[model samples]
Target: MSDDLKEFESDFATLAKLAVQQSEEDVRLLLGRLVRKYRQRHPELAEQLNLSLKSIQTRSGSGALRRESLSEQAPGAGVPLDRDSRLELLKEFDDRGGMSVPLLPSGLLRQVESIIQERQARETLLARGLAPTRSAILVGPPGLGKTMSARWIASRLGKPLWVLDLTTVMSSMLGKTGANLRAALDYAKRHSAILLLDEIDSIAKRRSDESDIGELKRLVTVILQEVDHWPDTGLLLAATNHPELIDPALWRRFDAELRFSAPDTELTVQAVRRFLGPDTEALGQWIDTIATSLKGRSLSDVERAVTTLRRGHALRHAPDEELVSAMVGADLGMKSKVERLTLAVEMAKAGKHTHQEISRLTGVARDTIRKHAGPSPRRGRGMK
Candidate 1:
């Protein structure tokens, strides 16, 4: 086919894919790009496309979206903003078909999946004289996938996730912080959007604290009332690293509370495989050792470490065994002497490296590895 025809086919396929995914914003963006691309050779087609684009923009600006589903509207449609700073109080993410399932433990994964299934079958519950879970609080340390899980829930339900930005909601002007928060909450309710209050403890501190100003106390009051009366049509999620700081009253209002912690051994191995991406096959032999060393770390840390390994191997031509050895050696400080010796034995038994190499990597002497795991294989069998 001709170059022009190939370009046209590619653009057509992209538009079809976006439409199927119900990605309105991406469809509009692609259409706008096409209009510019064909303006010279296909002026009439470009003009027609431009007119259709303008009509959609006019509808979006004229409040037609409120009458329709909020998820189908643009990312910025009707988002509340702070009065003094004019910063957006809520950040929008319409993940749709683009989100990845969060890497959570089986128990936590079931809970997250239950939330999604409940939302999907909400009408059936309502007909049976029941109500779906209206709100939940995710309590955990940072980098444990609370925010990502929220996004995944929204994506599975084919809706948009609106996250409350506490920095923007806390206005400089007196009494304005409460108003900003209220406005954002009201907007989310009006659209029935899945709303996430990230780092909720920042404003929902203990109400009895004598040092907290009246405005903060008022903010907590607002959240308490909102959480209690949040409608079944919308799902409200709050995540916090410091659950202790949250008021006791606020905790009671939530329908459920989900707790997150660092990855365990099994989940750590899964995270290593997922983070390894295309390099998983080439480095499969070292994944167990990597996961053993990275156990108890957050998924974000695993991703960073795996990404660094890939970059080193791809750019610097580092051997897989060398990269794995360096990573294990760096993490040896966190392991006890017995744990180090155990890892050394595993490496030695795998026959992928010499006992001396394992000793150096794990701080366990070669004699200890030999005593525990027998003799290492020929050096030619493993990485040179």
Candidate 2:
């Protein structure tokens, strides 16, 4: 009986704290449910509890469960500047989020580094008659670290990053989208934060196309006006996958334009080793082979492949030799079971696994494995 009482009290205390922190309606509903259940069997206790709730509600004017006005139940949660609005247009971020900047090709990395240096030496640049690079457009395929570059720039400048939500800012309500965009830009100015308009192609597509609508043209013009007259204190950054779809004049507005591409085999190989750390140094030969096979793939692809390989090895789901053999077979893109099993058997033969284990690993019968491995006889001469 005592344990039951303690558990009930503990549950009530936790719910009460949650109610205070989150919503008052939770407390009202909880107490009401308890009172209704006990009213028939314990009349006096139920009455007392109801009276206590009434007293508490009367004590707090804002605690009443009155219906809200239509204005309170309206569409379009206000822009990020509104204090009462729930949605955030800008996702604020700091350096400690632990997302490492991705490896880039040489020319791209050099341009990004120059941008970082220019931002770091703002005063020095002004003294030397060179202006600080405040605006830039990163154009590339997806997963090339365009968004990461924006955050890295923010971190290096010791500033917070506010990436705008294009979904919320772009509205079908006629001219309201431009107003929302302006409001977001105004909010960014207050904190001197890095404002990343990621995927800018959605809004600033090429306005010269005959099939384009007037609203898109107007939106691009608004962007142009804002970019030209934007304040010097805050940084404005934009990124896109389809740079060709963006207006040509808009390209000229940016101080620096950085183009990104998929990493080559050499960089991918180095990235794979660096990502794997000291765990695979002894397997350097196999690691280099992984690099050679992953040519023409992006850095993001390499990260995913390496992560899967390391995790499979760490989890002990399969032995290291077996896992490496399977991954190499997959990376090599073998088309059928015969080719795949042949490769696996060859890999296992090169490694330490025996013939029976190699047969089991490759999902082939041992006799069939021997037939494929053994030299083919002169079939027509031997039979006919």
Cα lDDT tens digits, model 2, 1-384, are: 686475456545644553543334435545665678568866887797688667757765647654222123244333354233445666766663455666888888888888888777654554344556778898888876888888887777666577885655553343566666667776565445578887788775434555556777777787887677554445788888888778889889988898988787678777888778766664555565456445566667676777777888778778666676676556656445756565545534444344565554455666775666653232311121
> Candidate 1's residue-wise lDDT over 1-384, tens digit each?
498887776677666655664545545666787799989999998998888777877866742223344556685577777767867788878788686789998899999998888988864564355668989999998888999999998889888788996645653464687887888998887666789998887775434556657878788888888897666667899999988888888888999889999988889889999988998887777777788778788899888888888888778667776777778877787778998888888777767777877776787988888899998777813353
Q: Which stretches of candidate 1 lie over 4 Å from their true place?
A: 1-75, 171-174, 204-211, 333-353, 370-384
> Residue 8's C-alpha lDDT in candidate 1?
72
Cα lDDT of candidate 2 equals 0.65
List the lowest-lDDT window of 10 residues for candidate 2: 375-384
TM-score per prediction, in order, is: 0.75, 0.61
